[model samples]
Target: MSTFGDFFKVTTYGESHCRSVGCIVDGVPPGMELTEEDIQPQMTRRRPGQSALTTPRNEMDTVEIQSGTEFGITLGTPIAMVVRNKDQRPKDYGNSTMDMYPRPSHADWTYLEKYGVKASSGGGRSSARETIGRVAASAIAEKYLKLSHGIEIVAWTSSVGGIHMFPPTATHPTPSTNPAFLSLIDTITREKVDEFVPVRCPDQAASDRMAEEIAAFRDKSDSIGGTVTCVIRNVPSGLGEPCFDKIEAMLAHAMLSIPASKGFEIGSGFGGCEVPGSIHNDPFILAPEVPPLETGATRNGIPRPRLTTKTNNSGGIQGGITNGAHIYFKVGFKPPATIGQAQNTATYDGDASGTLEAKGRHDPCVVPRAVPIVEAMAALVVVDALMAQQSRQVSRSMLPPLKTNKPEIKAMVEDGP
Candidate 1:
């Protein structure tokens, strides 16, 4: 059940305070160059203790490649990656309070009820530590997408505790719909986003405000939640299926899977709801082709679609398929539940009441750290959809290449099943 993706699957293992947390990644393209170097940047960003806003717990969170490569190239096999837990405080959840009483808004109660027993250390499978596997696995998917289609995914903190980067007049009616913000879709890069670390919102003034808000909450022994906006660029049109696996649906599915995510929305999301039908629609116009760079789209000779939209209110997708425009979306995260503030709650026996004082390292505001995670999940969804779309395109061609063209390439794709 921990597995994700249809074609490019990842099954994660281990838990917080466990010996190690890792994943088994399947369906990577063969002959692709991969290494820990490609994966470490995102892992480092997701790691805690980088700044005052994040949790104080410190670990290198370094990734080790266990299998699925030879001479630094993928062999078209299941890739296994692991990150050992250097800091384990299982005793923090000792038999006293955490073991007897379910922390409010945490997974403690639900997990115990479901399994009849649960890991007292952290929230077991529900901890944010579980996402280390996802972030690592997505790095591979990102490489493949970038090499194959020139795709780039970048996400950043958009709002933290209501300290938003958007203009003041902007309202929920235009959630991330600022024409200026949307214009940054292709231009924003990870380096630019990370420039304002601890609160990765791109706007300097807004970032400062968000940072201050997080500090206020931290001082109060509480936590705050925030939103992340992500954009996917250079995705070939016509990825994603009808009825079931819409690109937006897949994106939402992947984003919502992160530990604290509470809501998911695609371009013009709830905001578009208030606009008139004529104003909300994206009008199609003929597209112009641009020559690929040496590092760009691996020149598979697949012709780019000749049409695009005057506006991207559809968020690069129409119905279920992509329209070759950049896809953008926002994810909402709830406040971290295990705040250190003292609270009165009942015990497991439902008998006597008690005061609980939460302990452990937790981010006051998780939005900054969530940026890499959002990008990683976006990479997974795009790569999986890219594989599906390519297979379908090959199948539908008027002249079948399977019989006469590029036998070696065909063999490589065929090896999966």
Candidate 2:
């Protein structure tokens, strides 16, 4: 189903070349302040035609709030938002017969097999443009999460094609913003769009190489793909459900739903599989000074030194639940199949076919633009989990206070001054 979430359900509709694409977000709390402006920035980030690296199709992508808000405040009804497709190139798509001949490595063949039909122009529902509604709804979710909890999500293109970035370490520096969308061109002089025009790598030398590679491929009419890494921090524990609704499972479901995403791994993903169990396990450590027992702490005031496997072979997920650690994951994207180069294929009539060359603007690499999309999707998953957790513990009286009686603390105290 296109809809997701247990408590905070969201249903998205529309297509890439349709009149508009939008989403209806249900289960939002009443009285939360929301506006079109809040979502515009994220939409703009995902909008094509922003730079030379992306499709030249320019879209205003302006959001229209159709319902669920009164005077800029949510009324506890479903929130409806739409983004009009201002710059559509229906004519640019050429002939329908050509469309009937599926593009190589795309969902064209599979979609037709399952549905008996598909959008003639563009990939239709499979297009990246379909993500506009998701980004918009996610913007609202992010705002809510920020207001309620201090959680943050970020993603960056860690590698592209043959170039790879060194992992961040304690000794090495960390970027203020994730490197995913940051300008890749590193030079003493300020760069205009052209200067930062290659693959989005900050390292000047590597960026130069990447740019050369992209230019070479573009000239030859080919495409490439890479990887994106996302990090979610400050997420409170106990936000995920056990059994079917586990946090990682929910996140995997959402992330895999993105178009062109081929793989998903959290924490010490595939790499962990190579390590022995003894080397991969995280060892828990007890806190030296637990908060004063009177300060309303759990019996184990010092949380167990979590399943601190020395190395993160399991990717920070244990028993399908979050264990109060930073969650990290990577997604692998396949090369864009809409390359300009010609490929051999059969025509619709099954006649002896010739080569077909793709015509139209497309990214030589899509990993850069995917960074924001990944972050937006991650935010949606985390916020939904947070809301679900909050819903289950509806009674404040059920939780112990932050402070307790002095006598109770003394009674539980161990031998020591």
Candidate 3:
């Protein structure tokens, strides 16, 4: 099914070349404040033609809310949002030869066999444009998660082509305990953003090399792909369901839905496969203190245990559930398939051809635009998890009420400086 989530169902519709593309959110709680502006920034981030590295197809990608909101607040009805498609160049794909000679590494061949017909222009529903609705819907979900639960999600390119950069390891010590500590964290995150500007690498020299490689590849009329790492911090434990709809499973489902995504791993991911169980396991430790006496919870209550594993070999997930640790994961993308180099192919009528060259604007690498898409999908997954957790049949009295003073969450709502 194109729809996802058990508690908060999101159905995306329309095609790349269609009149418009949009999404329908079925289970957003009533009284949540939402607006078209809240979702536009995300669409702008994923829209093509934003920079030199992406396709030249320019789309305004302005979102329009059709229903489910009254005076900027949700009404507990299905929320529908649409983005009109502009700058479509159907003539660019006039050659019917694609009917027989499918683009290598694309869904053309399989889609034809499965559906008997496909959109001739821009790969139709399979186009990256399909992600517009997803990003828009996810923007609303993100706002809700932040405003209601203080959960924040962010993603960035960890590697391009084959270059990899180490993320910052110094945890922001209690920001409230010292104002200077908070400033330090903010400075580091900003520096990291700047260091990664050329290639999203924290290592300056490595980033420079990566930029050189990207420029060289662009000159060669070829494209490449790389890895995207996402971090979801301040996620409360127990958000994921047991048995079928586990957190990681749902996250994988959402991430794989992105265009050009081929592989997925959480926490340690594939790297952990080489380590033994002893090395991969996360050890639990008791919290120093617990809820206040007025809150009626013991300071050492249940140990308030945390996964203190020195290494995150399991990717912050244990027993198919979140363990209140930062959830980290990586996604792999293959090079963009539309290259300028000529290749052997056939005509639409099945006639053989010697060499065919593609004629259209395309990215040398899709990782940059994909970074926000990854973050958006992750936000959707976590928000849906929170929805599921909140909607559980259990009584609220059995669990501690959510805390609103989470400081790490504030960083998520504010844009990167």
Candidate 4:
């Protein structure tokens, strides 16, 4: 269960309080340039103590390459990396109320029920620290996706508690129908997102409001939840697997796997349900001809779809497959459960109830730090789906051509629908 993907497999190891926490990444294409420097940026973004909105745990989160590369070139082997836990405070959770009662809405209760044993500090594998491996491994995938396909994945904090970056109104009830929202997704970059740090929302007004909201909660010893919106551009069409592994379905699985994440929505998502079929339908229009890349490399010489939707209510996916348009989604994180407030709960034995005041370093709002994790997971899903689709295309190319006699079918096949 620690590993994910069929082609680009990643097996993460270690725990929150372990000496080191990292991952083993397999299926990297040989001869690609990679190194610790290429991975450290994302790790730093996901690291704690970046700002006042996050946990104050001072972890540099410096990454080290253990294997699978020589002189910065990938050997197509398993790449191993590690990050030492420098500021571990296991004693914070030891010899206190934690031993008697499980924190409400925290993983402490379910983990004990599942494994019958819990880690000495934090949530063990369930901790946000475990996401270090995912962020590292997905950075590698992001590099590959960028170099080979010109794909770009970017995520930013879009909401805090109930305050949204782009609130729906009578004029624009859905973001897909708003040109401003569409333009933002198309042009927003990581640098712009980071410029408004602490909350990571690009809009200055929204970022300020979100930051104030988080600070208010932190002062109260409470926590709040928010949403992160992600956009993937220049992605090739026909990337997702059918039946079970739809692109959106896999994305949901990946996003929900992150600590504190509670909900996932793609494109119009739940909002589309209110619109009628006539308005919700994405009518196809001719896509502009894009010039070839400077590298002259594309996903098997397939540029992009000849046709695209006039209105992308479908979110660049049709019937679970990417449709060569920018794919966008939002992930909702639940308020961090491990607050500093005292609460009445039954002990592990369920015999007695008492107030348990939890003490430890935890984020008042996780959306800012969660930005990189969301992008990382998005990159993982895109890379895995791209590889799977490429494998099928390569295999299908080697087969004999069909000898059918139906003119309509043959013409459609020859011309490409």
Candidate 5:
């Protein structure tokens, strides 16, 4: 279950308190330039102790490439990467209340029920530490996507607790209906998102408020939950499998797989249900001219679609496939369950009953650190879908063109950028 993807397979290893945690990334295109440096930035961003808002676990999170590359060039084999687990404190959860009673809402109980044994420290594989492999694998996928298709995946904290960067109103009940929100998605970058560290909200005022909210909860030994909004620009159309593996469906599967992720929704998402069909429908228009590909880069050569949607109420995907429009979505993470607050609960034996004050270093609000994780997962979904679509296109290209009398069908077949 630690593995993900088909063409680009990734199998993660290790645990929260284990010796090391990493992944084996397969399906990287050979001869591509790669190194540990290409993957470290994201690891550092997702590492703990970046700011007071995050956990105090001072992990350097230095990554090392064990194999799959020869002098910074991928050898067309599985890439093995690892990051040692330093500063782990297994004693923090030993010979204490955690031995009997599981932390309320934490994975402590369910993991024991599932495996009949639990890790000595933390949630083991269920911890956010598990996402390190995902981030690492996705870094490679992101690099390939950027170099090949000019794809850009960026995510930022959009809401913390009740404070929203773009609050819904009577006139603009959802971000899809708000021009300002659309503009932000069109131009926001990871650099701009990181400018407001600790909160990562793009808006200065909203970021400040969110930091304060998190501090208030941390002061009281409590925690808060929020949402991260991510946008993927320049993704080619025709990505995603129909019927079963719809683009949105695969995206939901990927997003929800991350630890603490409780909800996933694409553009207009639940809000679209409130609008009537006339207003919700995305009208088609001829796509404008696209700029030339970047000079001297390995290009995928996937042509841009001839048509695009006037309104993106469908979130860049219609009928389960990408429409060559910017694909955007939001992921909701639940509050970290490892709060310091004491709670009454039954023990493992279901007999002892008492307050168990959990002890551990945890984030007051995870949305800040969760930004890269969301983007990483989004990149994985896009890359996997792109590979699948590309394979199908290549296989079909070998056959003769369909000889049809219908002008409409012929026009559709010949349409291209």
Candidate 6:
């Protein structure tokens, strides 16, 4: 249950306030070029103290590739990665009565109720720190997906509560409020997303507003929630398994697993629910052949999506499978539960009511930090689905004639010797 992905599986280890945290990623293809550098950027993105909007707890978060790689290439075995905790301060809880009373809206109560005994960090096991392993592992998956299928996954802050870069509208999506990233979906890059540091919104004017709002929350010792939009480009069609293992379903599973995530939506999502079927349906059109590598455009026998929609209202997925369009989705993250604000709450025994002030560094808004994490999760889901389809496709194509199905057996029966 702790692990994710059937094929590109990652089992994360360690806990919050622990010596270190990391993961063991399995199912990576052999001979792929990989190194610690490939994994560090995502960890750095997910790490705290990168900007004023995030938590102040600064850990270098440097990863060490312990095993499963050799000569700058993956061994196709389990890849082990670890990052040590240098700034951990469990003693920060000494001033507060966290041990006596469960922080309101925190996991302290539910975890105790479920497991009977919980870790010292209470909800630390479910902390955003846990996702460090996921991001690291996904870096590997991303490398493979990019090389094999030219798949590119990028995510950014689409909205901070009501401050949306692209506000939905009735007709034509008014540009006044809707900062239409839709137009730039095909070209948006991680470099552009990171350009607006702390907010990561991509749009300059909109990003400034989002940053200001976060600053307001930070100054007031409060927090806010927001949504992150992600798009996956160049995924080959026929990657998903129907009836259960749909691409969107797997994407939902990966996104919802992130800490503080409240809701998940894909491609048109809730907005499509408002429009009529005639307007909402994505009409299919012939897709121009796409090359496996962008620099050198040449066919590689990977099935090109024969048809594409004029408008991606379906978000690159239809009927629970990928249709070779850019798959887009959004994840909504709730405000950080551990705030500096004082509140009146009951003790662990529920016998007495008292005030509790939470401690530790926490993000005022998680969406800014969650951008790369969303991308990481998307990569994991895509890589896993791709592997599944590859296994099925290769096995079926390379099958040997079975004794029962062989034509020679049919000929013998006809001869009646």
Question: Top TM-score: which candidate number?
Answer: 4
Candidate 1: tens digits of C-alpha lDDT, residues 1-417:
899988999999998999999999999989999999999999999998899889888878999999999989999999999999998788878857776688888888888789898887888999999999999999999999988878999999999987777643545366445667767886999999989887989899999999999999999999999999999999887689888898888988998999999999887887888878787788887776654432222224444336688877788889889978999999999999989998888888885568788888888878888899999999999999988977775665544334325767754532121
Go through the candidates in order and give each one's C-alpha lDDT: 0.86, 0.70, 0.72, 0.89, 0.89, 0.84
The residue-level lDDT of candidate 5 at 382 comes to 93
The C-alpha TM-scores of every prediction are 0.91, 0.81, 0.83, 0.95, 0.94, 0.90
Which is the winner by TM-score between candidate 4 and candidate 5? 4
lDDT of 3: 0.72
- lDDT, candidate 2, 260-317, per-residue tens: 8888877656655555666557776543443333213334444223223333344456
What's the CA error at residue 322 for candidate 6, in Å?
0.7
Evaluation by TM-score, superior candidate among 1 and 5: 5
Sort by lDDT, best first: what order?
4, 5, 1, 6, 3, 2
- Tens digit per residue, CA lDDT, model 4, 107-194: 8889988998999788799899999999999999999999999999999998999889888776667788889899999999999999
Which 10 consecutive positions of candidate 5 have the poorest summed lDDT?
Answer: 293-302
Candidate 4 residue 417 Cα shift, in angstroms, is 14
The list of candidate 4 runs beyond 4 A from truth reads: 290-305, 408-412, 415-417
252, model 6: CA deviation in Å?
0.5
Which residue pairs come into collision in candidate 4?
A: none
**Backbone Cα, N, C clashes tallied per candidate:** 0, 16, 3, 0, 0, 0
